[model samples]
Target chain A: MNWEFILGRSLSSAIGSDAAVFALAAIGLNLHFGYTGLLNFGQVAFMALGAYGLSVTVATLGLSLWWGIPIGLALSVTLALLLGLPTLRLRADYLAIVTIAASEIVRFVARSVSMRGVTGGSFGLSGFADEFYAVNPIPGGSYGFGVVQFSARALWVIAVAWGLVAIISLMVYVLMHSPWGRVLRSIREDEDAARSLGKNVYSYKMQSLVLGGLFGTIGGFMYAISQQSVQPDTYSTPVTFYCYAIIILGGTARVLGPVLGSMIFWGLLSFTDTALRQAVGAGYIPTAIMDGTQVGQSRFVLLGLGLMLLMIFRPQGILGDRREIALDAH
Target chain B: MPTDTWVDGVTPEPGVAKPDPILVVDGVTRRFGGLKAVDVEHVEFQRGAITALIGPNGAGKTTFFNLLTGFDRPDAGTWTFDGRRMAGMAAHKVARIGMVRTFQLTKALSRLTVMENMKLGATKQKGESFARALLPPLWRKQERGIEDRAADLLARFKLDNKRDDFAGTLSGGQRKLLEMARALMVQPDIVMLDEPMAGVNPALTQSLLGHVKDLRTQGMSVLFVEHDMDVVRDISDWVVVMAEGKIISEGTPDHIGQDRKVIDAYLGASHDAPTTPEEEQRQLAEAEAALDAETAEREQLQP
Candidate 1:
């Protein structure tokens, strides 16, 4: 019921490690859907590959986390190429279907009992983040302001995660302004026109898929490091949907849209959770009207309604140009 | 006419053979089911000249353009650009070989800025590499160069102010101009335009014609499909007439305008009409009689 506690937690959640990870993943989605007009609904598959790649390498194979990181990124790139090589030359909707299915397949494979020896089955992998934490520069002690505090280890994770997000954001910004980026946007708008101009359209689409998947894998790595564990459930279809929501909320194709969107999305979820729980505990609403369990689920319902409204009123999200969002080209 | 003449004092030198033709199509046939949509036998596009391929709707003019430019595959035929066979090349590969084409329906990238659309035309340039993208200085310099070229094209097309605007925001005529300007950014060896004047405003038609003329003046070959007889008559140095799927007649614009087969084709005469054996024999005799009469008339007129 404490307002100060709720506000502090909400603000920190908006800018915390999870937000950074989601923002990075959404940036990759922005590249795929927002800029390239590729309906890649399997972004989480890349993330899972990254997480599993790192976890299996380090924990199961007894390798270092450093070797695992690059391996994860390489695997994501390979996945992108494998998915893009055949499908990009076909209908774009094929990509949407393949990606969604691929991510689910990845999840099932990771959680399958047959792979228990290597993947730990549903229990997932832990203690693989020790090497990462051992390199943290922050000293011991919790630090923050106004009831919002993070322990030294948490601060270190946040620092690295947010730093990666910032660097990737800057890279996306500069690339989008370059000639190659211009070609990508043009292909999104009119691929036939680009082809008439001598662009290798299929090659460009493949490159974009690989690049975006790499970014998604980076987000997966951060998510694993932040939580200090790697689990199949963490990279589910819902995770991809959450990235999509973040991109839509921020504004597709805008450089800072994903970051801002992730912050706002997580912040709102935290605020609603705290406020609803507090209101129910204080008996501000009758139990017959809304029970604690019911209140717990209403936040997502409200969020869904908000998303529908945003799509109806401003399909371009908060900052996107309407013309940029209106993709008439197949 | 001051130059050499064909039959009946028709000027031939102005539209006759040039030093070299930029594009040659030989026996290109495109069939849709049983119907041969394009059955071009032989056609030549003169180097450094603007040639118009004109026919009424459904006469396969667009289909012929599509086949030559790699938008559609030919069932049986071959095409050459500057001595290189281009029969089965993909559209983009054809473009990379210095041949580019516009669509009958404008295909401007709606989401991109006018400038960005123009930049896409320069994709074959060296700076589009991933490594170059990471190194700003190397690619930045190239990007500015492309931007400068795009800006110049925009100015030439009188679309300079709209460079920053999304291509979809432009009017139909403006989009057409943007498409043309984008093609020029590639500096193609030969540019094929499909219905460049279709749906374009009358005021803009003159500018479009001027641009076509300028392309020839700059030593670039042009092959355009047009329905506007007046524009085709004015700008086209040579004209090829298509009917059903074949080049029924080809010569100067004046010659094609008055060709009897062309008139029959445009008037919707049934090219596939069944002919009785007796009727075919009678027609052959009539054709012999006409040929004799035409030969005598031509000899008298020549003297």
Candidate 2:
């Protein structure tokens, strides 16, 4: 077995550009589910809007990339408002239902044949990242050390993605410590108690929804730019589930939880895939037992089992204090 | 006493007015489908006094409190707080206008620290604003002031030691203390407490009593619901008795203790004041006829 190749690929994937994207999305989920106790099952929808918003603005409306950023952010906020307006005042489960449905609707719309001219339908969109790379401050050359190196284009994207992740993490840390964050936590624990204290509970919930969606939108931007394309299937339901697994793997409510979570999640996933693929290729295992194509599906099964064990032994997750979880309270 | 007043065994009128009123509730009625939970004609709470609202089970005491504080809407009513019409105002708005309430089952925000719970009670906090929350300088001074006030309240309630602890860790009595302390953070003109002493232990009862009285000494109007007659007699300056959604009587502690309607509502109608001999005899004949009618109906159903 090629231990060197396996270790290098796993290490690189652990801190790759996709890790930054998942970090951003999970950080936003932390705000919704952790601090606010909102069950947002469709965080992927917000990411989709961010990607499609930027892509559509540039490819269809012919706007500049800079203009696309704000437009994408605005679209996310609007989506949050639409989702929150009806569900924020009701039971928390309603949000989970509405968000999941909303995300699915976004995917179907992007894939619809009638919208092919604008959205590129199932094929998605490209050629929108030229301006993004044109402004790249990185010199044209390979960067980094031994087996984890990136080409100039990859290096530029990783730099911007990781930088955004840092800024967003710092912002979340600051906001969660403030009095406004106190309100969110209070609402999470007891909505009536917060209401009795003269807090506008519905308004605070809407604010949290919009704020988290904005963070998710930034992550979506990174995702689209990293690929230099926007596709319908890329922002599917599994993406949200993956982000959730990352959060649960790291911890919830803790500011650095999702950031560390994404790194470890991606690393473990790649490691398992490589190990299983090698075992099957070397004929160490019979084809009837497991095949090469089955290796991809097996990694998720491993993740599912890992999540189950985490929930059973430590529902609060690593880096998360037991008291930090308000799941039952909600 | 006024014609509408009930002083010891005299039947009281439905609506009663008080001198120097601060909160005037009129024609406030709430119904749960066919059941009328509250249907008061008129009632006035005296300014800066500790008023006890006492009633048996299902007397709508809590429902009345909910309407006054805007926690629940009245089906038909017009109430005025400080002479401002406030029947349909939101609960938080009512709190913002210097009126607030506590719950029967304490809502202590169990996940929050006692200090955090107290800070939430403060109104118009600058740090609570979405934009200002990000900038520490903009609200740092105000937050410090709020924390100082919270610390002071925690100390007064003897919860200073538990300030950093989560409210869920608190005992029943401590949760009551926290709820009371949190309500006082509003510095309200009127504090409506729903059964503040319901689950309190005897040890903390005296201290909770002192806090209620202290609200009055500080010139804040205090209204509380209670079932413990001793507590009502010991602390209340005035008492309002309710039965089946209507105010049956209102008077001082001494007069309310002897009021026949109050006694009947609490001890059942068998404790009602004696009627005239001829009136009693006529009621006895009517009862025997009803008994015979019930027997005839029972005999028919037996087959």
Candidate 3:
């Protein structure tokens, strides 16, 4: 087992393009669940909308990628408003159910044969990222140290994706520090009390949902551009769950929780995969105990166990206060 | 023991009518199954005066407060605050109209800091809009002003030391103070408190009383429900007594304390009575006679 190679890849994956995307999505989730007490379990649906909206517009309809960006954002905002309109006024749990169901519906629609012409039906869409890459400022060849190198094109995507995440994170920090942000946290704490204080609770919740969805959509755009494709499978329920894991692992309400959690999650995942494959090849464990095929599934199992322990011991993630995590869902 | 004996004539005084009462509840009835939780008849809360709504357990004091504050809707009645009807309005709208209320149980935003809780109270600030919030100079100036106000309020409530601390970290008494201080951040014209002293420590009792008094001193009307007779007696400029969903008595603390009906209501006698057809007629007759007698008494006592 090459320890150096594993460590380098794991560390880079922890803070790489995928981490940036997940962190962005988790930031949106933090706004929905952490600040507004909204249980948005289908944030990936917004991501899918952004991805599909861009892919369909650019690849299928022959529109420019720049046009697709705004269209994708608009669709995401519209989806959020539609989901929040009827459900935000209801129970918090209802929002969770609706969001999860909505994401599944979106995934199904994307894969459905009825939309094959536009969505590429399960085969997915590619070639839409050319315009995005054409604007890349990086000159040529691979860069970075040891086995942790990335191509100029890959570096360009990582730079832009991470840059967007940082900008969005900064925006979120600013908003949360503002009086509106204070109202959002207050509503999460006690909506009735906030209402008694003249807050338009429903409006605030709607705004939070839309804003968070927009962030998730931005992550979707990055995910699409990085992969140079839009596939229905990419925006599955696990994607949302992964964002939740990142949020919980970092700290639900803390500004930096998602970013840190994403890095740790991807890092651990990469480390476990590398270590397990290396151990299998080295014959450290008998074939009866575990095989190469089973190693892929075991990482998630380990991650789940780790999460369970984290939740039991410290429900608030590493950076979050326990009191901050006890949401007034009622 | 009988319906006839229960009809003791007690007249209500039609004192000097102010220009306009801050809040008026007329025949508001909120029924829960067979029980009428609140059946408040005509009751007026004067502007800029501290009024205490006193009753024993299950006396409908909190229910009446809920109805007036838009937490719950009344089955049959109308309520007006500052010439605006607020009977069926949402709680947020009621608050927007300058009538905010605290809960019997503390409803502090636990996750939010003390300062954030106070800032939430100032929701109606013009800079809360998305466009306004995005502009630094515009929103920043408004935010700073709100923060200053919240800081001052925290100082007044003696919670300035814990401004940066989450509200959940505060003691029960401190949370109550934070709730009260947060309510004032909106600059409400009338503040309704439900059991402000219920869970407060004895040491903080005086401070809570002072805060309630300060509301009146600052020309804000107060309607509070309290189980502690001592607190009610000490802080209430006027007391309204409720029993079985009705405002049975209204007067100064001394007058209410001495009222036989008010005493019976508190002693739980009101709940023991039967609501038969014959008893209802008899009570109605007694009420008419009491109204006449009270009018006559007030006329005689007038200047």
Candidate 4:
């Protein structure tokens, strides 16, 4: 059963470029759900916009990659404003409904036949990352520690991605500690209390939405650059659910929770997939039970089981304190 | 009590004018579909005095408070606070303009530290701004000052020992105290309290009343809604009574206690206030008619 292959795959996946992407994405989700009680169910839409905003600017509009970044960020901000305006003043569940619908709209529109010429339709887009890689400062070679390795190009992406994650994490930490964050927590506890105290609850909510969506936008950029592609299907409903799992797995409201959670989530997923594939190949398990491709899909089923167990056993997550989670004053 | 007796020798009536008014409401009306919730033609709150807004259930007292504080928008009226045209302003803006209010259901941020809740109440916080929040050096000194003020308030409210604990851990009475102390952190010119003594133990009600009076001593106007007659009488320099959607009377607590309308609204059956000789005679005539009918029936039975 190739223990070496299994451990190496799991270890690399834990800290790989995709892990960095999920980290940024989950960080954004943490801000929205954990701290502010904003139920942003369509985080994937923000990510998709980030990807498309950059890709469209580069591939369709023929702009530089640098210009694409700002455009993508602005698109996310506009999306946040759109979602927050109608629902934030009302009950929070309305946002959850609006966001899921928003993500679906983004996906369908991107894949539509009329937009194919611009968005590349179902095939998605490529050749946009050439400009991104052209600026890579890394020298061409293989880099590895004892257990995990990557090509120079991959390593460069990983470096930039993790660096962004770190900076964003630090920023979240600082912001959450500030009085501005205090106001947000207050709103989460009771919107009327914050309002009566003279806090502009609507404005603060908008700010949080815009700010967290910006992180997801960055996640989109990293996803595009790492995979060297932007596909509508890649930023689907499952991606957001994965983020929710990661946040709950690590801990909500804790700054490092998502970051650590991302690493562990990807690691466990890889570990389970590799183990199952090997078990099937070695004839240790019947093919009728599972084949190689089926093994790949079964990892998610395992994730569901794991999530259930976590909810039952340690719902506060790794870093969350049980006392902090009692949003229910009862 | 009003230092200058601004209420003395003044006309005791609905929509009465005060000598030095801090809040003035004119033609304020709020209707919920078919029901008129509040319809005050004019009402003025005296500056630096404790004013109690009293009413039974659904009296529109709370609705008027909500309109004045910008929590609920009035349909067709305007109000002025501290001489500023404040009608239809956002609740936060009203608070920024030195007027703040509390909810009937106490809204203490339960998950936050008691100290954190107090700091949130302070106004003009530099750290509250998004751009400035990231720079510790920019807001750190100001934050420290806010902390000092919060610490003082926590002690004053006897919440110092529970400063680091979650606000939810506090007892009901303590939550009410914390909410009031937090409201004071606004450094407000006036504080509107909705049911400050609600859900509070009787032992703490006295202290809460004292705090309301203390707001006046600090030169801040105190307008509170209360059902407890004793509390209203003990603390309020002036009393405003409301029934159904209109101000029925305004006077000292002593006068409000004796007003025929207030007594009827508070104690008498809302629909049956008539008690006169003419009404008695009508009732007697009906009884006499019933007796004559009964005598006719008895004659028939005897035959």
Best by TM-score: 4
Deviation in angstroms for B202 in model 2? 1.3
RMSD of each: 9.2, 5.2, 10.6, 5.3
> Which of the numbered candidates is closest to the native, going by highest lDDT?
4
Q: Please, what are the lDDT tens digits per residue for candidate 2 over residues B203-224?
A: 7998999898888889988899
Kindly report which residue stretches of model 3 are placed more than 4 angstroms away from their true locations once superposed.
Answer: A312-315, A322-330, B1-20, B33-35, B123-126, B268-303
lDDT of 2 by residue, A1-330 (tens): 777777887888888999999999999998998889999999999999889888988898899988889988999999999999999989999999999999999999998999999899999999898899999888899987877789899989888988998998988888878899999999988887788888888999999999998989999998998998999999899898888888888887789999999998998888888888888999987899999999999988987888899898988888887864542453
lDDT of 4 by residue, B1-303 (tens): 445567776799999889999999899999999999999998999989899999889999889988998889999998899889998799998988889898888888999999999999999999999999999899999999999999998888889999999999889999999999999999999999999998999989988877887788889999999999988888888999999889999999899988989887877556554489898888788889999999999999995
Candidate 1 local distance difference test against the native: 0.85
Error of 4 at A35 (Å): 1.8
- Chain A, candidate 3, TM-score of 0.97
| lDDT tens readout by residue for model 1, A225-252 | 8887888887889999999999999998
The 10-residue segment of model 2 chain B with minimum total lDDT is: B1-10
- DockQ-better candidate, 2 vs 3: 2
What TM-scores do the predictions have? 0.89, 0.91, 0.88, 0.93
- For all predictions in the order shown, the interface RMSD in Å is 2.2, 2.2, 2.4, 1.0
Q: Pick the candidate with the highest DockQ.
A: 4
DockQ of each: 0.45, 0.50, 0.41, 0.63
lDDT of each: 0.85, 0.88, 0.86, 0.91
Regarding lDDT, does 2 or 3 come out ahead?
2
Q: Model 2 scores what on Cα lDDT?
A: 0.88
